[model samples]
Target: MKRFVQARAAAFRGAIGAALLPLVLGGCATTGINKGQINVISTADEVKMGQEMSAEVAKQYTIYNNAAVTAYVQGVGNKIVQHCDRQDIEYHFAVINKNEVNAFAIPGGYIYVYTELMRDADDEAELAAVIAHEVGHVAARHSTERMTAMYGYQFVASLVLGQNPNACAKLVTDMAATGGFLKYSRKDEHEADELGAKYLYAAGYDPRGMVDLLNKLKGLETTEPTKFDTWFMTHPATSERLARVETEIAGFAKLTSPVRNAAAYAKIKAQLPK
Candidate 1:
């Protein structure tokens, strides 16, 4: 009887795999950022997946409730998004009340920055650099790409279709505990840094801000390793990355004056809870 039950379970698994094969092959799509590369998730479905996962993220983290600060972040993010490559979807930025130095972007353009990261920024340019990097990830469709690579097209399609209702929640839980979909490949990270520098320059912010932000995070990695844990996990900062970003920034035309906006950022930073 036990042998028969095991055989049935095996057959059930095989049947499920067979059923999903068609959907996986049919879902092949190309990314806007890299036309040569193929993605199994469509943009519309990626947006749906992002919407579901964002709701789960909200349930897991406390969103900072200050209207003025929220608007400020949205404004900065908008400046970056206007110059980003992917404008098909509207971008949303919010602040999480947690005191951790981390920021991440979900599929479809939802981005979250922790309060500690905001507090640590010395100027608006620094903050904008961070937001632009996350925007870079969104524009490149890195999160969904990573998800498709890790979980397979069928599992990702199931999450978007809501066929596996609990899967989104499980993904969010895993993201909070481990990096999950938030953890991107090194190549993805390099592309984001390069794109972010370009966006920062086009948006009228100093591209050097990206360099400064990396340097700041590098310092924190040594002095306050605990605060940098989450960011370090998802976005590893290395000397090579910093040097590459510097080279990218150096290639840009020299601006007579670039935005730093230290005073404005100071006023907004003052509003955060002590």
Candidate 2:
């Protein structure tokens, strides 16, 4: 009886794998950012998917209730949004009330930054750099690609694009917060940094802001490990990442007068809760 049950289980597993093979192959689609890269979800579907995930994230994290701080973050995010590739959808920027230094982007244009990250920035440009980095992820569709690759394109397509189901949103929330689901690959991180620097410069903010913020993060890794853990946990920091930002900044041939806007940054930072 035991042997018979084992055989049946093995056969079931094989059948499941065989059934999924065609869907996985058929679901593969090319990315808009790079023709060589494949993505499963379409632009419209990705937006709806992100909205659902954002709603779930909101349930987990508290939205900072300050109007002034939220407005400032939105203002900076909007500037970078103008320089992003996906301009069709409106970007939503919100501040989490948490004191942790962190920020992340959902598949669509939704981005959240912790108030601590805002308070820690040296200038408006640094804050813009963080927001721009998240924008880079959305523009490159890294989150969507990551999801499809991890859970087969067909499954993801059925969940997000096919039906506006709660199951897809729940899966996204679980994966994003816990497992390494939403965590970007090293290549993805580098690409985001590159695009972010370009957007930073294009938006009239110094691309060096990216480097400066990274340096600060590296410093915090030593002095305030717990505080930095929120960011470093998902977006691991390395010397390579820091060097890449510097290299990107160096590549800029003719840089305009990039705005650091120290005064504006100070005013905004002051608005955060004590």
Which one wins on lDDT? 1
State in Å the error of residue 138, model 2.
0.7
- Residue 237 lDDT in candidate 1: 58
**Model 2, range 1-274, lDDT digits (tens) per residue?**
3234335435544545654567557876544466566565778888877787777777767888788888989999999999877676779999887767788887778888888888779999999999998888888888877665555555566767546476666665554454223656778888888889989999989888888888888887788887765355466565788888898788786656778999988988888886
Q: Could you tell me the lDDT of residue 273 within candidate 1? A: 73
The runs of at least 3 residues in candidate 1 whose Cα sits more than 4 Å from the true structure, single-residue gaps closed, are 1-27, 179-181
Model 2 scores a C-alpha lDDT of 0.76
lDDT of 1 at 133: 87
Worst 10 residues of 2 by lDDT: 1-10
lDDT agreement with native, every candidate? 0.81, 0.76
lDDT of 1 by residue, 1-274 (tens): 3234335435544545665467557766556577667666788988898899889988988889899999999999999999999988988888988778888888878998888989888999999999998888888889877766555566787898899999999778767765324567789989888888899999999888888988888888899888866566566556888999988887789988999999999999999876
- Estimate the TM-score for candidate 1: 0.89
